[model samples]
Target: MAYSSGGRLPFESASKLGHLNVIESEWVQSLLKDFETNDVDNADNYENDIWESFDPSSVQSLNHIWAADGSYVSVEENHKELAFVKTALMTVEQGKIAAIDKEYPHPLKLQEIMKDSALFHATVFPLRNLKSDKGNIYDTVRHVIYDSMRTDENGQYFETLKWLAYKKWDGQKNNSLSFECPHCSKVIETGIPYDQDTGICPHCHKEVLLTDMIGFHLDMNEENASDSVASHYMLIMEMLMLFTVIRLQWANKDTTLISDTLFIKDGPMTLNGQYSKLVPNIREFLNFAKNKERPIHIIGSEKSGSFFEYLSLSSRFVKPDPGIIKYAVLNHDYIRRVIQRAPDRGNPYGLRTNWGEKVFVYLDENTHMVLNMTTGGYDRSDAYPKSSDIIGLQRILATLPALVSRKYEGALYPIELVNGIASMSNYPSAKILQDFVRDAVH
Candidate 1:
């Protein structure tokens, strides 16, 4: 018996071929346009001038701060109303004023009415000045309110607002120290110094490293130790700048309120490897602060490497200057060996080696021979290389004094020899060296 075969098409196959649950591209595009237009209109309607809209008398002096995960929300239905109130508070604190129509020209004017209305309750709270104000009732309440209002999509922004609040109230204590164990829920009470290696959590008995909490670990002897130290030192400088701006703003309450500060990183800003995610937010926050003119400064540190090479190659954007120079001082014998092995070409003080690469060598009384690898094998008797061609080396020499004054324990050689070798590979005459020393010493 031959029966007519009738089978339903599989949902996956139908969906894949755009036969089931398919969205038209034009429809999707129209929907996106609607969102885009709405966003633009909202942004245009947003009040840029918050100060004019805020009432000084209505200002709620937030004294106690709690850093809560900005992703939790209460399940209770009544708490939903409280969540709305909390959201309104957060929006105001975060510089997001409500869009007003003809009925409400100023949002603060509406806020005042809202504060007086039965629906809204106004409370005057005392501020806590101590860092040890954790586990307080007010903190717990604040956390509950924050968690109720926070959502997963806005979690990062919520955390950022929490960080900013912590800075305003506690002076950035949350970032500087850890009060709770990240791995364990145990509270750490020990007032450990920031540079300390570990803080013992009394409850957990675990050695909680401070660096682990602050997202940086210190190892002075690690390979590539200088890079780590340099990066951390640069961050410290930026943090100092941030603190300076905050202090300035706090001192002058009546002046124009500044929100964003700027930091100019010296090289291409990278947050790769262990610090990949943190660098972007740090840069963004810095840029935001800078745009607001919030007493911020930008700094960039440069050394000889790919970073400097890239900068030199793109010198059109940068002013014409000698590139940076980096040298490692070797023992006197080592220097002599290098110079002796360097095969001479017909050019004076210049050599062309077996590999057909030319090098210029100059021996200084400082027991160091300066080699010019960038200038090629050119004799000093020939046309001297442009001073601007070696700006990198010049910058290194210029910064040496400040480095030395900082008590940096590193190898050093005569700056004059380094400079002369950098500019002209033919070592300066003994008479010239003596005269240079006389001028430098005086």
Candidate 2:
């Protein structure tokens, strides 16, 4: 009865409400009274030295503000599921808009400037519903992913997106991607096949696809594997697309554009799980670019999380003069002891995956930023990341004023724009997608 044209039944309604009666009973409540969890409230304890203040230095405009975001929706029907993943890389020239528009610009002037602003692309891969798809689920997934990366948006994004992974944005070429073989556990390095191409594992002779390098296939199984693979696919797509944008900014040999542009990824600059293998490649590319004297500026802004919540709470203390900037580098010890309440022993935070350290910036009492930022590639050291390594924190912070958006609290314009491009409404979007897949199969 709860179904709304999405399918046979809403999954939530499948669970009967009869269990609530037992949970509401006094005897059941008494049995559950001893459980406890971490305190969600913030502590007032002092860490006075970590906080730093600076005079907001005036900086030149960023020539292009580029942001990347992605979304994926899974459609399931009659014991089968498929995922539709969509990602967008949107770019707008903040400097040009201000130079051309008047003090109170007309609506059409703004519209005309933004008419050609975004590059959007979408692709599909097999999930639970792979039986009817062209080939083996894993092989089909690899083919689709490879083609997705090769997307060409007219002439604007002519290069294959996979070129970011398969080759390099600024270095020597490697046509093959490598990973530990799932069957034999030996490292298998080879090129992805064209059409139904498959790599033969040298150690065990197990056939592998190029997409296996990322490890989404590890989470996949014959039973109800749609969501896990879909989520992983969405995240990897977002990271790859962001780097693809960075590659585009490189423009083959015109590297100065990299310095003049600002890249904003929707979430933290970290890739987790088996997907984390991409982190080293990212750090390597950033370092390679830096060694060549081309450092790109990128920031990841968080809107809803423990970190963002802490920023909202801590911003109460940051009331500075008109020109002063207040910020705190959330070092590992502070994060371990305070934010996460984890035992100080063990590995450094994000030792395997994070390319940037967390830094909380306060623009004003009303504008607080919880940022994951880094430059000169990802930190590779075992020791705590130093403040100096965050190469352009001050410069990037100075440019924030021109990019802030009033639509959301502490939101930046480019991220807000990409969110709009990537966000999909569930009611209409899911239902429509489900209908389309259903029609296509018939």
Candidate 3:
């Protein structure tokens, strides 16, 4: 590799794989044919997911909002990987806004806590080739999960773990949790009470933590798992933090607060891969709360994803009138075939994982909301359009107009603030956190 006058004398890396084999490969040609086979089946299927002549639902607006967002960064050096995750749950009160100084543009502004927000949870993982306090990263990861779900930053009862246990057993303490033992592979039903975090499996006589139901231990071993597992934990913690706030409001101080609060999650209300086992319990709790009449109001907005991209392309026809808030109910089939480009095998999309149904809300000209909303229960219906099944649909939709953000194409104000707090910028954040980790290891 030599630099000439133009600084362009670098040779390409040698490859014995061969570029010509890409076309000659039989499997590559078969994959292309498979994609072409389903091209027509995934088109013109928007009738059921669309809503034309619709007005936003009329319900008492909930002014208080709890928005959650998180960031995960990892550093790998010397054959060791360390990951840091920070999640922020910001509480924004709509009633706090007041108009002032129209000329100076201070008409309405949220208080700036971007530099140092107190309402955040931080966790570290020794993902690979590293030792933790427990002598093994596997147990250390377990301990970290246990610690966060058990308490807030102030070391009080956060109750997210209890909430997980509470949801697992019919949203009540008088029930029992069922799980298959990893040691013996036998189904065990334990009535260990909801408050307790860890218990022994009756069948195998082995220790089982409440967090074991989350399935993180499946991939994690003493040998060392990938640092990518930290991102999955970040997602779980984001939801856990949101639910911790909601559960506290529902059970502890003011139960009425849950009704007046709008919960906003940055991404979809989904638990992917191994962590998806909690979906049933999540729906159970939502239904339980609805039956108790404290009914939760939550929605997840996707700023950029395949669904957002799909809506951007099809926005013209489905949502032309800016004045009207047109929406589409995304069925599992459309998601699987058209959006996801997978085989639609007649099962609900994210059935075992997602707690909310994906809906595209066209809010005026510039903003569109890709909301993952729950209608007080799990989505079991194979029905094409599920707009009618959504409880408090109008209230959730009506509340969004105030929360929209003009900074990005599909943005929300609350989510933006939380993202800023939770975000880890590469310039200083990564370098600083990595340095801290290196120094902390004596």
- Please name the candidate that would achieve the greatest TM-score relative to the true structure: 3
Return the clash pairs for model 3, or none: 57-394
Q: Among all windows of ten consecutive residues in candidate 1, which has the lowest summed lDDT?
A: 63-72
Ranking by lDDT: 3, 2, 1
What TM-score against the true fold does each predicted structure earn? 0.24, 0.76, 0.77
lDDT of 1 by residue, 1-442 (tens): 2222224323322345455343455665344334333233233332222110111233222221111001112223432211111110110111111222322346575344233111101111112221224543333333332342243223322333334323433334533333555345554555344333346666767665433333323212211122232343233323322333334443444333322221222222233333332333343344444344442322222334432332232222221122222232222222223324444343432122110111111111111112221221123332233333321233223222221111111211122112222233232222211221233211
**Residue-wise lDDT of candidate 3 within 29-52, one digit each (tens)?**
554444334332243634334554
lDDT, model 2: 0.64
Relative to the true structure, candidate 2 reaches a TM of: 0.76
Question: Evaluated with lDDT, which candidate comes out highest?
Answer: 3
lDDT of 2 by residue, 244-348 (tens): 566655653455767877888877877777788767667767777767777777888888787887667666655566877777877777777767778866777
Clashes of 2: 0
lDDT of each: 0.28, 0.64, 0.67
User: Which is the better candidate, 1 or 2, if ranked by TM-score?
Assistant: 2
By lDDT, is 2 or 3 better? 3
